[model samples]
Target: MPVQTRVVYQVNPSMVNALKTIREQAYNASRGVINQRVRIQTVDGQIYEGVVVNVDRRHVYLTVPAMQGYGRQWDEDLILTLVLYELLVITLLYI
Candidate 1:
């Protein structure tokens, strides 16, 4: 039997900086884009896809995608960076 290999994805630092800008602009613009779909790239190279639930000057709250056979779950991971509209926004949240 052949074993299947899972490829791990890594997020770039420059991308993180761009995402931060969108986040800030979104905050400043007070746009309804809040709670929008977001892909977060952690410093650990873990890629997380979730929704932006809440945001502040310090951190961003994302309701991580649901797990198998689990009640409503969520995680507050640091926003190292993001790619919104093809723009990369890197935040210090990862650090």
Candidate 2:
């Protein structure tokens, strides 16, 4: 059997924040989320999954289905806005 090793780097808080800010700016400028399905995990461990309807420098708006009874349906007026700093991971989903 092959041995496995893991290494971790302890980054300074300021550096981590700076990296995240830079990443956010790049992502916003690219508009990578627009029209693409994405699943986001927030810092609080909350998960949001849906298609991106709109995006801005500070927030990303997602078009998610509203649950009615046991079924899910689209609601044009309903939108979920998530702040950039709160996002821990955003995975783009391709169908």
For residues 1-95, write the lDDT of model 1, one tens digit per residue: 99998869867978988777765664553234355765556445656666666655545555654454346443544332232332233232221
Displacement of residue 49 (Cα, Å) in model 1 is 0.5
Give the per-residue lDDT digits (tens) of candidate 2, residues 1-95: 99998768777877987877765774574287688888888889999788888877778888776655446555554689888777778889889
TM-score against truth, every candidate: 0.38, 0.62
Candidate 1: global Cα-lDDT? 0.51
TM-score of predicted model 2?
A: 0.62
| TM-score (C-alpha) between model 1 and the true structure | 0.38
